[model samples]
Target: MDYSYSEHKQCYVALDCIIFGFDRKDLKLLLIKRNFEPRKGDWSLMGGFLESDESLDEAASRILSSLTGLKDIYLEQLKGFGKVDRDPVARTISVAYYALINLNDHDKNLLPEFGAKWFPIDELPNLIFDHEEMVSLAKARLRHKASNQPVGFELLPDTFTLPELQQLYEAIYETSLDKRNFRRRILSMNVLEKTDKKQKKYSKKGAYLYKFDEDKYSEQKNKNGGTKMMFKPPKV
Candidate 1:
């Protein structure tokens, strides 16, 4: 190998994260209002230039943790955007990653420092550059994965009611689910363990709270031939 090849141009590599969260009411997106150019003061996904020492995946995780102060999050690479003009200031190619996180879990103190804010998915402000397209692709990827896997649980609290879980599915799929069928299918999987605690915030007679049964989930995965817990929905 030639030790020095100055013939090739070096362009910047960046990672952009489309973080998803659920607030027990609706699905949300975590966006930042960039404080510096090239699109200063515009809404955008959390991003950072790839450092010389880190892999692309490491860069994604670092960008996410810097915003949330949490690690081992559910993150996946969506795709790369390499359009010639995708980035205004440089010949930068961006790898887009999507993350699912519990809404109440992140460090809120960090948001102000980053100018980060949660926007309801439907009400997001205009994003800079190709960031808007990045969100659309990320959402489609999320829906497809969530259709086959219980990854949606990453956006939920430790314990939740059946109603809350149903709402989460509805939020994820963006369609109304038959409440009866939804509950039946979920309980049929037998992956949730009922807890003695009841969530009374909804009413005087609150819905029972349940936590995901890791043991049962593992058994189900084995029974499923290690396909990862199936979260397929009924024909709704």
Candidate 2:
């Protein structure tokens, strides 16, 4: 039963990545300034057209690696954009994915090689086409997941101070969280181990450094039957 009537509609597929990074004080997005056609000299999420021999996930990883020149990043598929007119050039569909990377862990030397620049999430320029919508959705998702899970930790250095962790969340939610409440909640999770090391760069007295204990965190989650461990934020 082979049907050979070539009357089906076909369209191109694209994979776009929203890469998030934290620079101790601000949360940023990694974008590329395009120099080619369609939208020359415009800032947009890094993306590429789907190739013939790859699955959507593989294409996404390839697109991300091509820009970051790294592997095994915290990548999550956000959603798909299939608005018939989303792309002015053609009737194409885009699958969006967001990644979280600790700024300290990434290699800056590769940034220039890929024409990628880190822009503060608040002061971002006008993105090409519907990329602004994609960014908005990603931010909402990040804020939601961060409230209950430690996924926000993916944007911090391996070893950090309590104040540093606070700053990260503050930047993520774009609001001031109660200092005492934030610290108390995070410490109560039992996933952080205080190190003798202190960060004296900002304060003369220095603040104690702490590292995220993955094993403890996992055990606690298992013990709690995978409940939503909330790091509640201050009410606006």
Candidate 3:
């Protein structure tokens, strides 16, 4: 039983990733200089066309791994862009996903091979196509997520100081945080375990290092009816 579907037009589907990393102080986005035509040599999000046999999540994972040599990364599907002329080469709809990676973990060598570079979120260059809009949307989502949850930990090292953690949040929010209030709020969450080790690089009296207690955090969240831990900024 063959059905004739010649009357309808088909468009290509692509997965575009807004890969974000925090370099201790500033939040950065991973962008590639497109190697192929339609917009060759222009800055674009890391993306690839969805294959027939894979789901959107799988496609996004594959693209990220191929570019960064990373796996099991923190990824979230953002939204879809379906403007008819978004891609001049073809009628295409792109499903955007944003990924957070610890800047210290990814393979630095792989970036050059793909002509990829990291740009600070605040000072991004002109991007090709609808990519700029995708970035804007992803940044908003990231800010909201970070404010309501501990997802920003994905962008930090396993063990970090309170100052480091606060800096990461400040970078994501693009503003200054009141250090005393920030520290007090985060400590009250009781999801961080203080370790004996101290980070001595920055101070005469080293700051204690703390690690996120994921299991404890999960238990607390479950007990609280799955409510997300909030990290709201203090009133100025």
Candidate 4:
């Protein structure tokens, strides 16, 4: 028997943001502690309901902005999660959005006050609901994205050194990379502007700094699909 549109049960759609940040050496994920009922005090992704007059993108933006005061962030839709009982308080079909944020740039106090905190991906604790799985998928996407696009730069400051860039990739891949090969591929892209500045804090050699040439990078990405940064992990 076919049911008419009038007979369909009304449900709610929520947007959850998995904000990822990179800080030179480690990759961090933004998580919030639920203050309301159902799972109060448990760490979960930043989320809110999709308003009747707003699109999913709009709602996601609103939710992210409300929690962290971040705007114009780079976000992509992940899969929709609706397991009926995924939310114990009510039936909610949540659409997940993965975002990249530069931690060095974002206001640190904006999050903690909202019951949110940044946790290192590897050091993440137990989370509420299916959040753990969501984080796992996000990590895989980050890895796949980093190899193609200049994603590591998203987590770094406007200017950085080759060693700093390598460290970001190493953190994402969770393995040390060949410095020589890494530098070669990055330099070959012609999208990095080598600055005269040096970062001598980490080394006595004082590695030269570089910044992404946004226009060149965009042109290269459009013309060549993307620049590939392939560094195989050491064999176990």
Candidate 5:
């Protein structure tokens, strides 16, 4: 059987990925310097045209891996971008996806080859064509998702200290959190398992290290009927 829709116009479809990473202090965006035409040498999100043989998610995953040499990354489809003149080169609609990766886990050597660099979320450069908008939307989605779920753990190391976890939240929200209250709230959830280990990097006494208990969290979520895990700021 032959499929034909000749009456309608045809346009190119692409997938853009907003790769986010946390370096224990700040939230960063992985961007690539475009070496090709239509804005050569400008900073842009890693993206590729959607292929006939792959789904949108697969396209996003492929593009992310091609640029970062990472696999099994946490990815979520953000939104679709389609404007008459969004792409100057051609009539293209891009599906945007955001990916979270642990900074310490990615392949560093692949970055240089793809002209990729991590930029602090607060100090990003001027991006090409509505990419800045895509980034802004992605950031909001990340903050929202992190608040309702344990997705923020994707940006942290396998094992982390309480302070490190707090820092990650602060970086995501771009605000300071009350250490005492924050610690209380997080522990009250009972989703973290304390390991018999301490991190001596930030403090003299060292903070106890902990890891997210996925099984426990799932059980808790089920018991609570799918309640969201939100970060409540301490009242001043």
Candidate 6:
């Protein structure tokens, strides 16, 4: 086999994080005000160059931890943005990763150092470079991920109600789902355990609380033949 150096060119690869958190019944994104030149003082995603000694996951963790004092978050590489003119100063390709974290679990002081701020997804301002596109993709991925995987737990408290869970989905999907059907579908999955507790914050009737059933979830995965349910609403 013959190799041609001309067929390939060397370029810098960077990792950008689209850190997502849920709060006040809304979806929010973690954004940093760029402190370096080329786009200094502009809003952008948290990003850094991939170092030679680290794997992609390691580099992502390092970058996020450095900016927000966070580690071990639900991180997954989204995709690579590799247009020749993406970066004005250099030929750099950026691999974006979307991370999920419970708003109550993260450090309260993560914003001071890098000028970080959590902005609601709908109210996001114009971002520098290709970050705006990355944010849009991350939001769509978040909706798909929450539907199929249990990753939404990363954004909720250890204990939650069915309504709380439903609201989380509604916030991400931006639509109201029928309460009865939502509960039926989720309960039918056999992956959630109803608890002895009830939450009364939203109504006087109060709603039963629930937690994820990790063991049954594993078993369900193995079987993969359980009855699938969908929520149906009564006439308004």
Give the least accurate 10-residue stretch of model 5, judged by summed lDDT.
Answer: 227-236
* TM-score for each predicted model, relative to the true structure: 0.94, 0.95, 0.96, 0.90, 0.96, 0.88
Put the candidates in lDDT order, highest first.
Answer: 5, 3, 1, 2, 6, 4
For residues 37-122, could you state the per-residue lDDT of candidate 3 as single tens digits? Answer: 97788999999999999999999999999988899999999999999889899999999999999999999999999899999988
Q: Per-residue lDDT of 1-236 in model 1, one digit per residue for the tens?
A: 65865888989999999999999989999999999998889999999999999999999999999999989999999999999998879899999999999989999999999999999988999999999999999988888777667788899999999999999888877888888888888898888999999989969999999998878877888888875535565343
- Residue 203 CA error for candidate 3 (Å)? 1.5
TM-score of 5: 0.96
> How do the residues 92-202 of candidate 6 rate in per-residue lDDT, one tens digit apiece?
999999999888878778687789999987799789999999988998777766767778878888789877888887778777888887877878878888888888988
Segments of candidate 4 deviating more than 4 angstroms: 1-4, 225-236
Which regions of candidate 2 fall more than 4 Å away from where they truly are?
Answer: 3-5, 234-236
Q: Please identify model 6 stretches exceeding 4 Å from their true place.
A: 1-9, 203-205, 225-236
> Can you write out model 5's per-residue Cα lDDT over 1-236, one digit (the tens) per residue?
99989989999999999999999999999999999889999999999999999999899999999887888989999999999899999999999999999999998999999899999999999999989999999988888887789999999999999999999999888888988989998999999999999999877999999999999899999999996565664322
Give the clashing pairs for model 4.
Answer: none
Clashes of 4: 0
Overall lDDT per candidate, in order of appearance: 0.90, 0.89, 0.91, 0.83, 0.92, 0.83
For candidate 4, lDDT tens digit of each residue in 50-98? 9899999999999888876888878888889999988887888999999
How many steric clashes between backbone atoms does each model show?
Answer: 0, 0, 0, 0, 0, 0
Model 5 regions more than 4 Å off: 1-3, 233-236
Pairs in steric clash, model 2: none
| Model 1 residue 145 distance off true place after TM-score fit, in angstroms | 1.5
The better candidate by TM-score, 2 or 6, is 2
lDDT of 5 at 15: 95
